[model samples]
Target: MAGAQRSEGVVTVVGSIHVDFFIRVPRLPRPGETIKGHGFAIKPGGKGANQAVGCGRLGLPTFMVGRLGRDFSELLLNNFRSNRVSTDYVYVDEETNTGVAFILLSDEGENMIAFDPGADYRLAPDDVKRAESVISRSSVLLTQLEVPLETVETALSLAKEKGVTTILNPAPARELPCSLLRRADVVTPNRVEAFMLTGVEVRDVKTAVEAGRKLLSMGAGSAVITMGGEGAVVVTSEDAYFVPAVRVKPVDTTGAGDAFNAGLAFGLAQGLPLVEAARLGCVIAALKVTKFGAQEGLPWREELEEYLRKGVLELTTPTRV
Candidate 1:
C-alpha cells in the first residue's frame, strides 16, 4: 500500500513477465487485410511485472512470485531488482520460453495486442507453495489473469487461508469459476470483465451496479468496475460510489488499468475503505494515460500527492452513465 499517500507494508505480486514488441500502424487490419506500420519499439513489460514495479516505486517492500524462461530470466529478474522489488522467490526454468506480446498502436494511442503466454501458463500450485512464508506475512497479494486459472486459484486459496487481504485484477476478460470469487476480498474488473461475469452489458453506472451485485452474489466481497474516460464504480454490500476520471489526451492506454489496480491494492493494504481505494486508483490511472508504457507512466507517491495538492481533485456526481 506504499504506492498511495502512505508508505508501508509488504505487497506481493504473483504473475508473469513479458517482452513487448510494439508497432504504430495507420489502422488495425481486418482478418484478411494487410497494412503497413510506421514505427516499432521493444519494451521490457508484463502486467504482473508492471504492477510490481508500480508498487515498488510507491515505496512498498514488494516481492514477485513467478516463472520465467532461461532466455529472459536474468533480464526479468534484474528488472524487478532494479525496481527495488525482492527477487528471492522468482524462479527460472529451462523448458519454457518467456512470454511475448505483439502490440499495434494507432497515431491516437488506440491499440490492439496479441500474446503468447509461454511460461506463464506453466505456473502451478507448487510454485505458490514455495513462497508460503513470504506471502503469509505480506499485507496484500496482487494477481491478474495472465496465467493459468488453477494457478490463480491456488494463490487465492493460500492467501485466503492465511487471512491476508486478497485482490484480483481480472484483465483481458475471461469467465472464471464462481468458486474463485469466494477467496477474493476485492475483485477489480473493467467494464468488459463486468459484462462477462454478470451476463449484462455495462454501459452505465446503473448497469455496473447490477453487474456488481450479481458478482457479489456469486461470492466476491466487493466488485470495482472501471470505465475508461468516464471513471470508476465501487460496489460493496454496504455502499456504492462513482468516481469520474480526469479528461486528458491519452498518449498510450497500455498500462492504465494495471496502474489503477496497483493504486487500489496499495490503498486497501493501508486499511483504506473500498471507495477511498478506488478514488486513489482512479486518479492514479487518470495520470497514467498522460504518458506511455505501463510502468513508466505510474506516478510516485510524492507525485500523486502533488497532483492532489495542486487542487486536481474533481469528483463528478454520476447519474447512470
Candidate 2:
C-alpha cells in the first residue's frame, strides 16, 4: 500500500512511441486483396504514449520515457506537451525513424493494425537507467512489449528494487521469462493475450478465470484479464472477481485498452482496491470507444468522474468469479 504512494503522484511510462495512421474501411480485406478506404487521419499514438496521455488527462503527473526519431520528435513531443504529459526523458534517435502504426477501422468498430517499430525498438536498458530518478519517484511504472524486452525487464527490475508498483501490459503477446513476470505487481492482458500466455481460452468469464489464475500461477502478483464487451476479470491466488464493462456504442476501439490501463494506474495510485481499480478501468475504456482516435477520445478527470456517477453507479457490484 505504501509502495503505491509517490511524493508528487507521478506515473512513469517506459515503452514505445509511434505516430498512428488510421483509415476507415467498409470491411477488412482478405489477405493479398486490395480495397478502397473511406477516410484517413494521422495522429499521435503508441501504447506507451497513449497510456501516458490518458494518465495525464486523469490529472496524474505522468512522465514518458522512450525514444523518438528525429523526423517526428517535435510532433510527438508537442502532442505529449498538449496532453499534459512530461517528455523530459524522451530521446530523439538520429539514425532510426520514428515508429508508425497503420490501422484499419471497419464499420463494425473492429480494427486491424500493423507496425514499423523503428526508434521504438531501439531503447536500451542503459537508457532506462539514465531515468533512475524519475522511475524512483513514480507511484506506478507501466510498460509494454513494443520496445525491446531487455529494456522492459530492466525497467521492471529497477522499479521492483525501488519498491514502486509495476504494471506490464503484455501486448503482441509472447512467452516471457519467469523472472520478469515475478517482478510485476500487475499484468494487464487482453483475452487473446491471456490465452497466448496461459494456453487457456478466455472467450467468456469462466475461461477468463482459468486464464487469469494460470497467469498468476506463472508468478505475477495479479492478473487483470480484459475481455472487451464481456468486461474484465481480476484474478489472484486468493480471489477471482468479475468487473463488468459499461455499455456504450463503439466508434473506434483503438485506444480502449490504453484508456483502461491508465484508469487502473490512476486508481492504484490513489490506493483503491484492485477490483475497484479494474471497475474504473472498464468505465474509462467504455467511454473512450464512443469517440474516434486513440488519445483524442481519452477523458479528463472531471469528465470521467461525471460519467462514473451517472452511467456506471447502477452496475452490479464486482462479483466473485
Best prediction by TM-score: 2
lDDT of 1 by residue, 1-321 (tens): 232222246788888778888888877778887889966887767888888888887777888988887677877888788888898877787898988899888778887889998988887789988988878888889999998888888999898777778898887798988899888989988888988877879998888888888889999989889998788888889877787877789888888888888888878777787787777787888788888776778887788888888666655333332
Q: How close is candidate 2 to the true structure, as a TM-score?
A: 0.97
Native-to-model Cα distance after best TM-score fit, residue 274 in candidate 2, in Å: 0.8
RMSD of each: 3.2, 1.4
Error of 2 at 94 (Å): 0.8
What is the per-residue lDDT of model 2 for residues 203-237, given as tens digits with 9 covering 90 to 100? 88999999888888899999999989768899978
lDDT of each structure? 0.82, 0.90
Q: lDDT, candidate 1, residue 84? A: 84
Clashing pairs in 2: none
Segments in model 2 whose C-alpha atoms lie over 4 Å from true places: 1-5
What's model 2's lDDT at 102?
99
Number of backbone collisions per candidate, in order? 1, 0
